[model samples]
Target: MTRNTDDDGIVVLGHPRSGTTLLRRLINLHPNISSPPETHLLSACARFLDADMTADGVDMGVLAGLDFSGFSESDVLKELRQFSFGFLQRIAERKGKARWAEKTAFDIFHLKNIEKLCEDHVYYVAIVRHPLDVAVSCTEFCTSMGTYPSTLHEYIKRYPQPIEAFAMSWLETTKALMDLGRKRSSRFIMVRYEDIIEDENEIMNSVFQFVDEEHGCDQAQSIFNSIPEIGFSDHKSLQEKSIHKKSIDRWRSLPSPQVKRLGELLNPLLAELGYDEIENTGEIGTTAARRRYATSLALHAAKTNETDDDTKD
Candidate 1:
């Protein structure tokens, strides 16, 4: 299970609640792969760099004001890269595995930075899920976590409701990462969450094969087959302790009005992802409603950041 100092590492990324955790656990079951809890390395680095550079000297408020004593930006980046490799490498070795994988939903925003930091030693596997399903899951999770929006109107304004935000995030993250994958071709792969749920063996085998090809190893499919039923407690404490088809079309149960609104906001992307959409529009219009929706979204963003900050503690 020994590896060269420059061995390739795997990265699993997705929109939050899009099955990234499940993928991590599934891949970790393989004898040759070591998957660990999210390090948030890439994300933290991206945020640091962003916070360090400010147009008006006040981007992240206090973060922008704080000064690093002697380290230059390049110094910071180099140190992060070294730490990332050192951490994952040690985990892999401890597990007697030849390869390591890192999963962080937040990494979805910093793919290019990650690529540059990992150099030629990183490979990506981006997972995508249906927007409706993602929104549904997000809403349920946030509510259970006590972060859900109050009314249907409020939900329409913020995330875990209005559902438009999830659609936008999914489309943006998927498109951006897919673009990176295509540009890097051999170094990146995109897997759909639905595909993994429907045909796990086939999708997982392909993932393992990708890892093997990149790392110059002939991995056996039996390793994947041997993984027992896996489960996880999401942010809401909802347990997905085993793989099942129960969640596949849960969005179909959504009210017709909400579904129509989602379709209106995300028609092209939904259609591209092979989901049904409502082609007609011209519904739900009013100045007051528009203002409320905008305010709701702004509040939602603030609340989301608050929750994220709390989680970091």
Candidate 2:
């Protein structure tokens, strides 16, 4: 469990709700490493030029000022790289975690910038989940409940399916990282969300070996056990594993239409990710699937506020 002063870091990337938080906690469990909360630092610091950078949090007001399309050219990306890494280096030093790591789900959406930040003595752990689950989770995220559709219909604007978008996004980002790994051959690693969920110890052992190999850190299970087992009380604890045996696959019970439609949408991505694409089951327009993964404490908070209002009346 001894800390190594060499100070290597890792960047954990996946789309929002795709298990990046869980990944951070698992890795931080290793004695020689540290990752403070799910720091969305990569996106914030990379956008520092046009962004009003606070100490840790990105200002919502500053974010609203510009669209993503307005980002600068290649010359600007290089400038932003130096500024972003300098800022992150300071943050990591402040954290007292000799070997630092950072987690941000949306960082995958900005793979190019993420690559730059980790170029200097850092590694990566990219996590991917099923696209259907991602869409269902994102639906709850964007609308606070699952009201998203899985299929495209004629005369219905023919919009891209949410599941499809999430799937394609996961594949594209992971591929980019893998491509980088092939070139560097010494700087990156890949992981799957399902693997972590199914057998955490095995996955953690693998990660520990990789980290130990990359950086000369002496690590053991005792140090990992020392990492607190924080439960998911609010959104904050998603970075820690929820103290529940939450199964990862909930789409099985969803109605056939949705399942079929979602299958159609994610088929290409499934193939790309080495997942078998299920055939449309002649049931492609139902709505029985819905996301219900919010922390109970959040629901309780809402109920408590409502009750307080009634008591005042």
Candidate 3:
């Protein structure tokens, strides 16, 4: 059978730190597919077209003295769709692959626009993670990059406070994206980060099923063998090969107060995402977790001091 390479464009999207990158890398390992780091093509195109200029509703007057009268809105839209589809097809062909996958969380906001442009040729996968875990990971990530504020007040003054804001943002983004997915359920799938960590093969196989393809269990496992130290733009690195169980439930190590606040703010959305509701016991088990965290910090400090002393000696 002749392959319609242009029709196999896959879009992987979720909030940052929601395992979208890892999923894209794994998908790329398939011999038939390849994904370059996110191009943000559709999102950028949508922004340039502006909110008022939709696929079917582009106002020629908005072009600001350009000669768009030569073509109708439908004419321009058909050309735009052809251009978008051509971009994916050319990339896949350049890489000598039959399929191309693109990952960019920003595209979540523009899925409807992309659909209006590309129609049935695109497949969407929304990666969902526990809001609490997402909040903690995003917080740690920003701090490691030296961009996060140290205190809740300062954080709120600049950006949203971590757990509350991040969790709420995740809820809002995922729900909006999923709502779009529901209208075209056959072409969309939502995969949980926890499920991927638990059974990478199973989750990937399900993803393959959504794309109407045979399972690539061997390709998936092979890709999991040794993670390259690829970063988010080569600055924030994944320094580990094995997917650690520690990646799951990362909010547990967070200070009790933060965790409690997250639980409170995120319980409804958590339930909506099919996670167990956080039990609202106030700081009952706080001490033990706090002590463990404190001891780890102290040990880290001691190790650093020892290394300095040894260097001096």
The local lDDT score (0 to 100) that residue 301 gets in candidate 2 is: 90
Instruction: Assess candidate 3 and give its TM-score to the true structure.
Output: 0.74
TM agreement with the true structure for every prediction? 0.69, 0.61, 0.74
Q: In model 2, how large is the Cα lDDT of residue 270?
A: 70
| Lowest summed lDDT window (length 10), candidate 3 | 229-238
Which residue runs of candidate 1 sit more than 4 Å off their true CA positions?
1-7, 52-76, 148-162, 213-238, 274-313
- Model 1: lDDT equals 0.68
| Number of backbone collisions per candidate | 3, 1, 0
| TM-score, ranked from best to worst | 3, 1, 2
RMSD of each: 11.6, 11.5, 6.3
Clashing pairs in 2: 257-283
What are the per-residue Cα lDDT tens digits for candidate 1 across 136-246? 776676666665433222434655444666656666777787777777787677788888888776788788777663322233233334533233234331234456677
The lDDT per prediction is 0.68, 0.58, 0.70
Best-to-worst order by lDDT is 3, 1, 2
Question: What tens digits encode model 2's per-residue C-alpha lDDT throughout 91-137?
Answer: 55665645677776666656665665446446667677776676566
Which of 1 and 3 is the better model by TM-score?
A: 3
Residue ranges of candidate 2 with Cα displaced over 4 Å: 1-7, 48-96, 145-178, 181-184, 213-245, 271-274, 283-313
Deviation in Å, model 3, residue 125 alpha carbon: 1.1
